[model samples]
Target: MKLLLYPNCSNGGVTAVIRSRANADKENTYLVVFTNDRGGRHSFDDLDNVTVRIVPDFRLGAFLTYLFNEYVFDSINVFSMPKIVEQMVQRDELAVTYEFHSSNMSIVEKEISQLPLDRVASLVVPSQEMKSKLSERLPKRLLPRLQVVPNLVDEFVFNTNGRSDRLSSLEEGLIPLVWIGRLEASKGAHFVPRVLAQLPENYVAIMIVSLESDPTRFDRFLAECDSMGVAHRCHILMDLQQQTVAEFYRSAAARGGWLISTSLMESFGYAVSEAISCGLRVAAFELPVWSRFEEEPKLVQVDAGSVVQMASAVAGKVS
Candidate 1:
């Protein structure tokens, strides 16, 4: 009944899974963080039955020490880390489950293909589209192990009462467009400038960049904004707590603004769901994964990679 949860970093979605499971089965769950990203550590601090372990270096010596001395986990749940799953498979006593969260399967395709599929208990995915994508990439023998488990957002994100104090400093009359994700090429951070350029001059993009994001790339994104003459319309925020993020969603909704997802791909749109839960409008690139939400009035889907179309959709939503 004991479970070990190993997430690559303290990502919001990954941490949500850890929190939900810990709350559900507090007595038998353990959380092991393998990176220096401490973004989601607060969520685990007060849990009575959850054991939290941190291995900052992730060096071979440190990993071996953790594996030999503290690795008595009966079952391991891995998130977005194939190498960890590979390591766990070597220990035949442990039942391993991989929770697939990324739409970009190329990164882990080789690792998954080479894995001991028979030893894996399940391959959990968040969306039917992801399940379908994995099906095409994986061997037919591994199809039976695929499980569809939707991503969970924090309950606080649904609350609409509070206002984000961080947004208070923003000038009046500007429409706030909230963007949440890493500042990476795959997530479409580089496209924001062009999208903003296409929007009304009063529109401002409030980007909540993930802690696991690359600093160099983010700086480059900002530089690109400057070059594009849209830097003034961009507001960058980072390392925010879940409750604070909810407030931002509420604030945006209250201001007649909406959330925007510029991701090239999404296995599951947690940010989009959270924005909708808070009664905010959303404009995102059309993806097969978001087909389920097509009927939702608050969601506006545009052609993928069409910056002009995305900008037009957001402008129309706010207008």
Candidate 2:
């Protein structure tokens, strides 16, 4: 049996990634754990081979002690979790793979530097972009143990020709712009309304984001939309399955729409990759991490930090 641990609710990409992995693994019985920091839905609770548990108390001691008493795990894989190495600092022959999912390398470096290296079997990152970032910040001795493992985006085998009710408000002939991520400045969601404002009125925006992830930012994003006079044109949708989102992306692509991103940085751009997987063109800032999709003709990268450049990339020759 393997153990997968994370500190977030079913908020965003990470939870979905775990669910995909759990569903694919038929050989191993896994225990998937999460914390109720934000208190939302469970994506893995219904899986047959996976046992879903939540730790209400987030302290490292409380978390470990509670799990230790209940069941035994063969190996443990942790996602962006803190201070667990310290708890097992004195243990011998432990099997632990610490996976860093954060967009910030400084945070990853600080946490790894504090860990007792002997307790950790290996360290894994989601992409080469992240591994490169970690190599720059982490100590020279720790470099050899670091490995790059790209994240998995769920594949859709079927297409939905029917339109979802959430998207019914969008009329025909409008260029439906799509954005997906948490409502955070890091994810570049704040840039959506401003970019929408710069574009022509014929372009309407549809945002798929987690409202519970950042309520303050969610409210601020909406206010910015209202301030920019694009709130009426901005449609925000939440709590959607990947298949439904794929259908929406497919529909958007059919109407000559593009999946647009304004994220400042991405460890790996799951939204963009998933959009491309769904056969939609993707537009994002020209960040190093986006180079993974360079071969994809559908992905057009605009100059970073320029709202006008982003607007013009999606909508040709706009004044």
Candidate 3:
């Protein structure tokens, strides 16, 4: 058996990885998720041949259950939890792999630096940018363990077609600019209204965000939109599935619109890539992770933190 342990399911990216791995090799894969409440919907709970164990409390008993289990796991892939890795290292029989998924390298470095590097079989990161960042912070000897494995978008994204009837409120001449992610400061979602304010009146901004337990932020975003006088042109769609999100991408593409990302940091631009796969144009900040896609005709890299530049790029894409 192969065990994949993540501290929580708060991150969709980690869940994506787990889903991909489970689908690829379901027979031997077992996912051990630490927490259940924080993140959006649990997307991997129904996979066949994959066992999902939710241990809310990360205590010694839980650790003992994993450590002294009858089912022997040949390899264990841990996602960004040094403490978990520390405990798993106690089991001499298991090969532990540390998978890094965040752009917050300082926090990651601080946590990982305390672990016994020699016991780790390998260190996996989602992108080359992450590999380089981790290399700078880690010991020279430990740098050899770093490996880059990019995230995979869900296969359903590629085959989805536009649903013209769904977004009926959008005017015929308007260009739909889609933004997907958590509506938080870190995600740069708060900057969306300012960007939308700069765009042409016909270029509407559609936000498909997870509004779970964060009503204040959502209300504040609406208030900001109203203050900026762009609330009328902005639409918020909540709790959409992967297929529905793909349809939005397709719908935007059909209308000659595109995806816009204002993320301050990204380990890998999964949503951006997915948008591109759906034949939609993308205007995103020129982050290190998107370097490979810079040459793609569908992807437009705007100056980081420049809302005007991002808005202008999206405006240019509008017919």
Query: Per-candidate TM vs. native?
Result: 0.87, 0.88, 0.88
Can you write out model 1's per-residue Cα lDDT over 157-266, one digit (the tens) per residue? 45666665557777788889999877778788888888899888989999888775457987899899998899989988886766778889988887888898888888
Clashes of each: 0, 0, 0
lDDT of 2 by residue, 25-44 (tens): 76888877777544335555
Steric clash pairs (candidate 3): none
The whole-model C-alpha lDDT of candidate 1 against the native structure comes to: 0.75
Kindly provide the TM-score of model 1 when superposed on the true structure, using C-alpha atoms: 0.87
Worst 10 residues of 2 by lDDT: 156-165
TM-score of 3: 0.88
Give lDDT tens digits, candidate 3, residues 81-148: 77767777777877788888876666687768767788898999889998888888777988888999
Total residue pair clashes for candidate 1:
0
* lDDT for residue 292 in candidate 2, whole number 0-100: 79
Relative to the true structure, how large is the alpha-carbon lDDT of every model? 0.75, 0.76, 0.76
Give the C-alpha miss distance for residue 158 in model 2, angstroms. Answer: 9.0
Rank by lDDT, descending? 3, 2, 1
- Stretches of candidate 3 exceeding 4 Å from the true structure: 26-28, 38-42, 58-68, 160-165, 211-216, 317-319
